[model samples]
Target chain A: MTELSELHEAPAPSHAGLDVGNVDELHEAITAQDKTRIRELLDLDLEHPAELADRLEQLSHSDRKTLAELCPDVFSPALLAELEDDVVEDVLPLLSSRQISRAMEELESDDAVQLFEELSDEAREEVLEELPEQERREIEESLSFDEETAGRLMQREFVAAPEFWTVGQTIDHMREQGERGGDNLPEKFFDVYVIDAHFHPIGYVPLSTLMRSQRGTLLRDLMDTNLTVITPDMDQEDVAYLFEKYDLISAPVVDADGRLTGMITVDDMVEVIQEENTEDMLALAGVSEAGLVDTVADTVKARAPWLFVNLLTAMLASSVISLFQNEISQLVALAVLMPIVASMGGNTGTQALTVAI
Target chain B: MTELSELHEAPAPSHAGLDVGNVDELHEAITAQDKTRIRELLDLDLEHPAELADRLEQLSHSDRKTLAELCPDVFSPALLAELEDDVVEDVLPLLSSRQISRAMEELESDDAVQLFEELSDEAREEVLEELPEQERREIEESLSFDEETAGRLMQREFVAAPEFWTVGQTIDHMREQGERGGDNLPEKFFDVYVIDAHFHPIGYVPLSTLMRSQRGTLLRDLMDTNLTVITPDMDQEDVAYLFEKYDLISAPVVDADGRLTGMITVDDMVEVIQEENTEDMLALAGVSEAGLVDTVADTVKARAPWLFVNLLTAMLASSVISLFQNEISQLVALAVLMPIVASMGGNTGTQALTVAI
Candidate 1:
């Protein structure tokens, strides 16, 4: 494996850092159907999965498909996770079921669930069947949770310890687990929950605190019991609010009877906050979605329903203008000033609605 | 310190969980100048600072002031941090300089900077003078950075170690620091930066890694060098994008020569994400700010500029209608359908703009 130090030494290919001039070159390559040039350009960005995703997003649908087909290895599991849902959906059919299953296996449960959501039902079944039984079970269990709930957000792999254990025991156990190279442990965790008998989490110890504490310190004594316990049924928005309110690094999710089930990390909450924010902003502007890389047809489809509702509201406003027809005829200025009044009122209403939301 | 378990055991006073019927009762208490009843009502919400902030936001300006005056303790530093800028501004003059300084003292640097931004120049001077010298200096240094930049967003107190230190040595250093309970250390930290002799951050070790590593492991070998380094002048929105892309828990900010300055944590980024979200949402609606707790006059002030701009645009639309006056007189039906067409075009333009933004 390439060490992080080597990765840091390599030039980072971030979306924001990409030159506008390079984009023109990229466009030229795509237009020429120059597979060799496209591969070279993609090679420059292959190390930075996010940048690869961004570059993919910048391409037209046909260009994206051609590039992906030409250099399938560039579309790694991490790269797929970095791509937007729309882009991922666009590319999912290009890959084999084994490839899709492999990507899902490598990702955290929440991210895998997200990719699963974007797949066609047929594709989903194929991919699920290809996955290892344990991975499939975890994904299926996560899918059992309603969309936009804590259950959907929490990762199944978490580190936990009995309350009776000391900090030293927990540390040793984690070291042993790491050495064993098992798939049971979380890929990364910030806190370890201290669970009581019957597997109810009583508290958690931040890794920083655990690191600084004495080996003899009991897990329960060192743990912070004031942490928020997330119920699986809690709405993602409420879960986000709880995280913001408490400045939580990670929170334990509990079953209905309060047994520890999974954990939701702040990283996931950050994504939720942005997603919810985008949804609210787009909804207010009478658009279903922002559709940054959307085709003309997609854009129209996303916006048509909101436009129809707006058409009704506009007609109602016009009808009220008609009610003053007699008044408008006496003073033609009324017709001229009429739109100003209506427009001002509309702007004011939007201002109030924006604030309220 | 109350354990989070005990806090959880206490009935959670949340805005969603608040009795809708009690809003009227709250209004009556304010109107009757019933301080005792108001105190009792607020006490019901005391455990949940965010809920208290929400309840306070729902009240009229005078009522919020009255409630604060009646029960000053309810407006704790945590509660103050949760309130909107406008609401905080309204209550600032109600408190003594001592109170303001104490609140500032209690909050994290990023939060303190927010409160500091809202204060009047005269009040700011008074509050600054009242703060302890070290805190005052820290606030001054932070204030020196431009608003909405990493410098303004970063907290000064962070953990760092010399690059040559071993894991055990670093852990021992943090333990001694935590034992000392000095103001120099960060109240909470996620990772320890490994610094060179020049105080430049070379790499960082997540506490999780530090906890699991052997005592003899060199800090240099344990640290992850593939880290994003933020500059002081970087915009907060860009900072947020980095956090989202990298799923960063914390990032180090460096000075011109790449010396470590401070760190920006994910907790502060959560708030920044929301604030930026609100700003973008309101800006789309043509409002200067989303003054959720604004008085009628404040609301008008916030909306007036947008309304004036709309007035200009509406008049332009009206002038276009006036250009067809002769045709309108001949066919009054033109007058009836004119607004429908105009409104539809307006809505379409907004939809395009929303998507582009």
Candidate 2:
């Protein structure tokens, strides 16, 4: 097993050796060692049991139902993040209440909220009851914020320092806190807010500056006052633009009183940028929302109504065509050339709309 | 002047200090002391200069002839990047030969190619002659590539290392190269291509892994074998899809013989992503492109053509409407609510088209 592992991690080819059958051959080679080849093959495609759960979801109901009977732990939260809502709804009902509770506890707030949003009311109540009191309260509190706002998107874990502290004190605090189980401070952070006695955000000290500054420097003097403070209720689009325009790594989210509540990091903003881009693209396309892990029926439902509207618009345009029908019948050249003109017009219009929207 | 300079640098209330009173005032604001401020404001709201340029170009011949005396460098390459092709044409003649040479030199190869492609035969010849021999050759060569190909969009600056080198040696090489003239390398980079003796890309080591790994790790050992190399002539859309599918940050571009030519960084890919999203959005809207910077006339032109094509298509649908006109005339409710069904259909079609496209 060790030798095979080493072989799998071998040095790269001098040039891209990607071939069409790469995934197939690689899988076959891995499975040649054992009769557990089928399970290994599935594991190869999915690095963990959890991812298998997600992909299995895309399969038909019977397939997932059968697969679940064999491997229940595949209903992991990581897998839930990857599943479409409809498929998730189908799969969640089949899972034991214990399994569902475990998955919710394991997932991030956003992913957990999304999965919870898809559940039937009765199922939600049952699952909520299963969670530890603290976890359930946090999830419920997070849910109270408007969907897609900073309050909802921000992770709860963050580090802050009082304005009067020195850089040395702040570092010592972080060190002590980490040792005492503060190790979960967001995997990445850019700035630490300096709050006043009342927790009002007075300034921000960037991590880079903190790293470079002398240890004894007072935190207040080291902080940047030209901060872009965001309201919890601000639209995600505005947040994304502020981040882009200011080249911000992180910004503090505050309430109406300007007190620091949560910090919005660049990583979260990256998702917002992508989402906003998707929204603009979808909206301009005339759908309020397009596929965000949408199923076939959901996709159909989302799109069909728009096409029907187009059919009506087409009908209206055809009435204009009928207005010129006598003129068209008198001169078929107008009909043929008319299409050319209209085609040109349509192309031009599309170009214009692309620029405008 | 120093006090004013300080005041200008200070961050003011949002939209408070904006003075859009006159063209000269807008010009002064655009060319402010802070380059960042200028860039930010240009991105914000203002009359689209391209629109003004188009209108000015259509003025009496005497007015058009005298417009060359206006501030020349105002038609900077950055501004040119923002302008539409038709608008670019109007402004080109107004620019002095020196300014033209400067703008040409400042522009990326792709942008230069695009601008030069729109110039009149005599103007192109004159401008081409004014450019340095090397730059003129580079632009002309790049212009020769088919539009919307990888060759058209790639930047010439990229970093690659020999496959035999350790990660330490590669980092040292990058530092040394940066110390020399490689400071002109793109502002951001992601992957370091490991090239063979003949300069063909063998594999890639992601920057993230490189940053985390021990310095002495061999490049070949660290490389990811699942390299996605793009050919110069590949369609940009396909390239974008590949990037999205593999979550690529950067990829090496290869020529017909599989020899590495240059690298395409993710920042460039980011622009492509935005452009493609915009294209899809507009295309789904039944328009070819969004005319964001278009004039009322340009907007009308862009939309009229599509509306015209729509007219023909509508007539086709109207013939259907006519077949049922009597049914509609008898049932007034059909006339009233028929539009509702069609409107819904149009919306649905757009939604589906948005997703499908």
Candidate 3:
């Protein structure tokens, strides 16, 4: 939380963090095993966790391990959260149980769930053991929900107010809560849900609207009743569609009984949109992963399954061509044109399939 | 703008707007050419422009044209903004110059630019001439920028404050401006840029922080200087990457001299992400467009160029195989095995290319 506050206070990182000079210098340092230079370069980027994550991703596997060993603190929770899933998987085993637990604790519930889900059973259990009782329970609860559902995507922290509250009262409450500086409020929120006595979210007021409205305006009057409510079991793609269709910044997640449970923000939706897009693109190409940062072995493994399927399809296509072999020998021209015909047909079929998808 | 306010006040449109029943009824009405029934169905969906857009897309080309002729207002600026580029292109010729110009004027600058860009030269001229002088200049200025750059993507209207202004001054300025209800301010804004004497953006204060902060706090003191400023020439894809990396809601778009020109909001970014993903997916498949709502003819036109390229490649591969024509005739088995080998190679090559991309 302190780091989160500091993140807002610090100037934005220079995009030059990924420039050729820095990468080459870091590569040279890692090559020479110059711990001092590596530490110096990393320390300069300490406040910019995203830049640090990008730098680590560009490093050799052993160099990444060495850097982690040299400065475990650089692999902060924010940095871990920012890393690609494959990169996180690679680095997670290198960290101690204490580091894993601390990172998990620092992340929001949804992010903590993602990190824990990626871990091996034994490591996950060890990290879970290190967490406090309350946080452990929350993570466990989140894990119970099916993957890629609203339940799994939503963060537990959210801001809610009774419908009867006035705009002034809500503002004062937020100010007082900000001063209190506890975990009761979301780290950042775009809107506040207005709930009824039964805790069913009746509507929502965008923070902008709340800010602009007269102080005496009741939350009920100010709230947009046309708010979209999401169910915990709803698929994440459907949730993303809702966000896009409505231009929603944040949405309230409801339980089976229609009571507000947690909230899903647009930042989470942004990630989901990217993930789903990657999934669709990869799946269409018959690969299992995006393979953006995959090692050679990983890429081979991902492609092997699709290639195996392709082999069977190829054999089937060949079998059909075999049936026409006798006719092909009678006419040499047939041999030349046969591939043209087959090629045309295959290309046309692929074209149809692509458009259909 | 009135529609925008109504959009906010009205309860979130029923996801049922595109339900099977309504679509069926609308389809039946269109097929039967029941103008009254079509109007009834569209009237029921008047408040839900997105749903209306979806329904219109699902219709046959003639039916969509008929529906447009029956009730042109149903094809509102928001609906035009929501339609697919291809669909919009198909429908644009059917609308009057007045309808086209009015729609452009009603939409935000980014959306207006998008709609205008899809028009044919003669129609674009007609629409531009029909528009008010000031709005025409704005759209023309937007068009002057290269497509897919920050300048093309940013809205002309945004909120910015002098660095020396206190939070109270900023709040009062916004309130007074809101009351004035002119086109000078963005319809919605999440943050206020704090600019220096030179009108260069120095930092920003999120609306939430502005609301929570004391009124007397100076803008310079309250602003979070850690801001990611986007240059007007920056590619939209690069802008999207920055937004994703930083989880940014909005970023300032600056000119060559570094003065803030306009702003790109998350809602626009969300649309850009979806468009980029669609582009990538289609490009990988070798198709020119997603062909989501395309007719058979349109689909063929879209796929023909890629299929032609495939034809050339296929012919080249066939020519390579023809080099061994003597060997193949001597051993009949070579004919059967040739296809298997070619198929396997093609599949493997495709797999590699997919991963590389």
Candidate 4:
């Protein structure tokens, strides 16, 4: 196991988690303009991008700008993928169009699309111009879909095998493909879809099943046909529900004619589930913190609408109580009863509403 | 594509989801004692066990009791694993000790442990006596851990290989082991642990990576050492956070000696995330509906405590309002302001609490 002290040279390819303690130390290093210490603390090859992204998110605004300026390597492509969208929006202006496009090329398709989406319109045009034609088309085609739909979420890169291929043939193809490290093969995948002439997935086979089966077994015979097929336009939440309900490792995303166009994997579905849950929680609380990213003004704007609605209702409630002002003046006990009853009723309503959501 | 009508003979191996309409039809079929129809509605071959479990969950208690009596096979082992804990508690009593032991034998180790935990002490003794010695021991060992720790959540069955083995050798071993249909090979897995002599995972090879590697490539060279190792004693929520943060498909669970014991998969983490999120939501609402399974009484017992607490606090507020009774008597406007102030303040507090949570 790699110790925390040796993080900059750690063997882990990526660290998706970070400790807050690391951030405090990084802050001091940035403030002192210790470029050597910054590089030692954040090696491009060894450290997890998430560790850096988290550190940057917690930094003071000027510290972040200074760090990015002092150590441009700090905003590695992987770090761009892991950074929160708000932070990404803030950081993109610091990079050149070539730098941004190079980052897009280095990342997987879904991440590349996300990074592309963060650019300002003028920057998007410049970055898109700098990207390879193939890379540029993938980003543009993915962006054509409605946001939060399966089309937007699916990676154009996936593994698909014809039904005629045997396990041995499929393995040979994958080995050849993996060597090339092309856009067609996903960075990591669990299942191989068995497609028909029209590119529809007739069935799918988990890699584990393919591995343990006889090499001579046809992909068709080895395949499990009970796939929960997802259409491109399906809502991401619905996509997530299918993944959860089926214990799916990955599902094929298809076109109108039912041809497999792309695939959505479980790792992405994990995020959608959390997002939907947070949305549910926020909805129940009557707030909409969904897009409130950077400014304190944004936070206030997000939180204020619900309070304003609450105030309007509160005023309505006050009017109802005022109708009984005569009775309250005659008996002080009536006034005491009003607050108790109102408060208890409000709490009970909140409890019921929470469960309903 | 498998249309909605092809459900009974559907090629899909499992459905972890259910349609409410299907549950309603199952209810009608049960009332008529139409065993053929019931079986057609829930063919163990093509249907998802969750579909049946959901049906049982929604049935009236009397309908459920009668359905179990009329169709004993409705409680399939897969359905036993898929069932919500409350529904399992209700259905377990209807099964013979022999039947329960059989279900435990059929299910994966983690699910077998969950089913065992749902049994009454008397029933557990009977079921344990009926189980095979190894199965009985596995359940007992799993039960020794805290309810929501990694030990309780992980499946004891996993695939691990020595680092010295080549890809071909590892593949051959897996094929031979998978052919045996034993407890040690998980039904599905994505990664093969490359472990030391003592069974500590030093690295892991994603099955896809194995598929793409040349047959003669050594497992040691092909493996990724960026493992996010989990301990048996870790809280399941913490385990889930690591999965979401690190985008892990499966993580090896280790014991005190840092030797791999079991593995937790993403499917289980999905449930943990939802469970934690729900718990968080309910806690925010000042309620605990955690164990309120079957009865209306159970619901009241769960929700009343929070409301009672609200009543006590509201009474304190009422006393404070009474202290201002003389002021309110002079100005009716002061009384009107109280409800408006109390309501808006409560809403703001609720919003802040929601965010803090």
Candidate maximizing TM-score:
4
Higher-DockQ candidate of 3 and 4: 4
Candidate with best DockQ: 4
Whole-model alpha-carbon lDDT for candidate 3: 0.79
Whole-model Cα lDDT per candidate?
0.80, 0.61, 0.79, 0.82
What digit string (tens of lDDT, one per residue) describes model 1 on residues A1-357? Answer: 112233343233354745566667777887787878877777754246776677777777777676667667767888888888888989888888888898888887878888889899999999999999988998998898899999999998899999889978998888777667636678778899988777888888888777667778899788877668888878899989888877788999888777888999999999999999988888888788746677789888888998898789878877887887776676676677778877887777877788888
Q: What are the candidates' interface root-mean-square deviations?
A: 4.3, 10.0, 5.9, 3.7
Clashes of each: 3, 48, 3, 3
* Model 4 docking tier (incorrect/acceptable/medium/high): medium
TM-score of chain A of each: 0.88, 0.76, 0.89, 0.91
Provide the TM-score for each candidate, comma-separated: 0.87, 0.61, 0.89, 0.93
Kindly list the per-residue Cα lDDT of model 1 for residues B183-288, writing each as its tens digit.
5567678889988787877789987777667778899998877677888788898888888887889999887777788899998899899989888888888887
Compared with the true structure, what per-residue lDDT tens digits does model 3 show for residues A1-357? 222233332223355445557777987887787878877877744345676777778777887887777777778888888888888988999999999999888888888888888798899889999999999998988888899998999998888999999988997887777667645777767898998888878788987677566778899988877767787778898888888887889998877677778999998899899989878767776788744576789778878887787778878877876787777676545566566777788667765665565
Off by over 4 Å in 4: A1-21, A290-295, B1-21, B290-293
Q: Candidate 1 or 4, higher TM-score?
A: 4
Q: Which ten residues in a row have the lowest lDDT in candidate 1 chain A?
A: A1-10
Better of 1 and 2 by lDDT: 1
Candidate 4: give the clashing pairs.
Answer: A15-A48, A226-B12, B15-B48
Span of 10 residues, lowest total lDDT, candidate 3 chain B: B1-10
A208, model 4: CA deviation in Å?
A: 1.0
Q: Sort the candidates on TM-score, descending order.
A: 4, 3, 1, 2
